[model samples]
Target: MENLEKAIAEIKQALPGLTLLEQEPLAAHCSFRIGGPARALAVPQDVSSLARICSILKEHQLAPFLLGNGTNILFPDEGLQELFLISTEKLQKLFLLPDGAIYAEAGVSLSRLASFAQQNGLQGLEFASGIPGSVGGGVFINAGAYGGELKDVIESVVCLYAPDQGLYELSKEQCAFSYRKSYFSTHGGCMILSAVFRLQPGDREEIAAKMRELNEKRRAKQPLELPSAGSTFKRPEGHFAGALIEQAGLKGFTVGGAQVSEKHAGFVVNVGGATSHDVYDLMLHVRKTVYENSGVVLEPEVIILAPDYKLEDKGPRVHGNIVTVNGPAEE
Candidate 1:
């Protein structure tokens, strides 16, 4: 904690113009409306400022956590006193490349990207219209729904690799996308800056219609009205998480103020005044029950950040000589 305090002080002195929110409550930033205060959360205006902040933290042998749209996250009520968070909310650069592909920054929401694609008569992004995460978060977890994933449309990604404070661009194959994950998901030191999406041309009206149809389906099936992280658990290989949960007779079950949604078994909504302990305990019970009922294990889709949650530094990977960030890079 002392190290974190010193690092925070250094970051403030280094970037005087940065918007650093100290002791900010995590609840207001996330979709669940649950979570205690984070020690320090910095919002950098652009990728350069973000990189500088990371470089400062690295100097202190400390690492920072990047908070995206805060959709699929469960931050504990006890708070993160030892952690420094960097929010991508201000990295809102979205445009089209000269080569007819869409360019979006880390903070650009998936819905907005899909809308932009539609307005430009581009297809293939309609499936992401209702996903409540930003481009960075979507790419982190190869987020998909209704038979579509970001990996399918993403052409390339640019990121700042923290270990060396250098920038690198990775192709779709290098991203190593898989079900609900990407290389960036498992690898540390890589902070997503932006991405270029390759999409096909289609009728503007038809694209809009498709997006509307998908959003309507989402609204009907998801517990959007309630305060909850989208889905509590990932889909098990041979079966759906919701189906197995329902089959185990755990639907609509409550622990404190947290309950498996009566509307959608997949969601664990905060009925009212739910604490993080309540949520953690409830999810534990659900996992144990589901595993006992069906021989399958359920993995949480939500990124739970308890007071003790810490990510081990996995060092870094070598990004080839295509671009030397410190030498000559975009950001």
Candidate 2:
């Protein structure tokens, strides 16, 4: 605690005008609305401020967690006391280039980005219209919906690589984007600053129609009214996580305030006042049940941030692969 206080003091001196809060509740930052308090939370106003804050933390030998919109993360009930939490919420600068490409800061929401593209007659980002995360977080995990993903439109990224406290521009191929994974996922201590998206010109009416269609599909299928970290588990190879849970008869299963969404088996929602422990326990139970029934171990899609948290399963366990279900999996 003494070291933390000293570091905070140094940060305040180094970066004036930066928003700093002590013992801020994580629930207020995350979409799930369930977590304990963070020791210290810092909000950077822009890329330069973010870089300065990162440098200060590095100088003090402190590793601060870079938080985006916090849509797909689970913070522990005990809270984040070990690391300073840095949020990109205020760094939301966006503009369009003359060449028809869009440039957006990390903190810009995906929905806003898509809307911006639509307003300018750019077509490719319609799939992101309903995603509830910042551009940085979306790109970090290759966030996608309705068959389109961040990799599809990303032209380049400006990132603050923490190892050297240097900024570097990485091309699309360099991002190494795959299904719900990216270079950021494997590389620790790197912060995404902004990204340039190369989108093609299209009719404004057509783009808006597409976005509206996708949003309706999302609203129809997802439990948007409830608080969730979106999908609980990644889609297992050759199967969907929701279908597996449904097949295993685990839909609507509850552990404390956390319950599998009856409306959509893919989500584990905080019915009301759910704790991180409850969500974690429910996730474990769901995984075990699905594995026991189908012989395929489901991997979590949600990023769980808890002290000493580790996956109980070593990896996916496939036992004598065979058809366990009668028909094709449902979305």
Instruction: State which candidate has the highest TM-score.
Output: 2
Local accuracy of candidate 2 as per-residue lDDT tens digits, 1-331 = 5666778898899887889988999999998899899988999787887788778777777666778999998888888777788899998889998887999999999999999999998889999999999999998889999899999999999899876898999999999998888887766766899999999889999999999999999999999999999998888889999999999999899999999999999999999999988998898888788888999888777877755444445233322111111111111
Candidate 1 — which pairs collide?
none
Q: Rate the local accuracy (lDDT) of all candidates.
A: 0.85, 0.85
TM-scores, each model vs. reference = 0.92, 0.93
lDDT of 1 by residue, 1-331 (tens): 7878998999889899999999999999999999999899999999989999999888887777888999988888987777888999999999999999999999999999999999999999999999999999899888899999999999999998877888999999999998887888667668899999999999999999999999999999988999998888888788999999999999899988899999899999999999877887787788878878987777777777653422122112111111121222111
Q: Tell me the spans in candidate 2 whose CA falls farther than 4 Å from its real position.
A: 310-331
Lowest summed lDDT window (length 10), candidate 1: 314-323
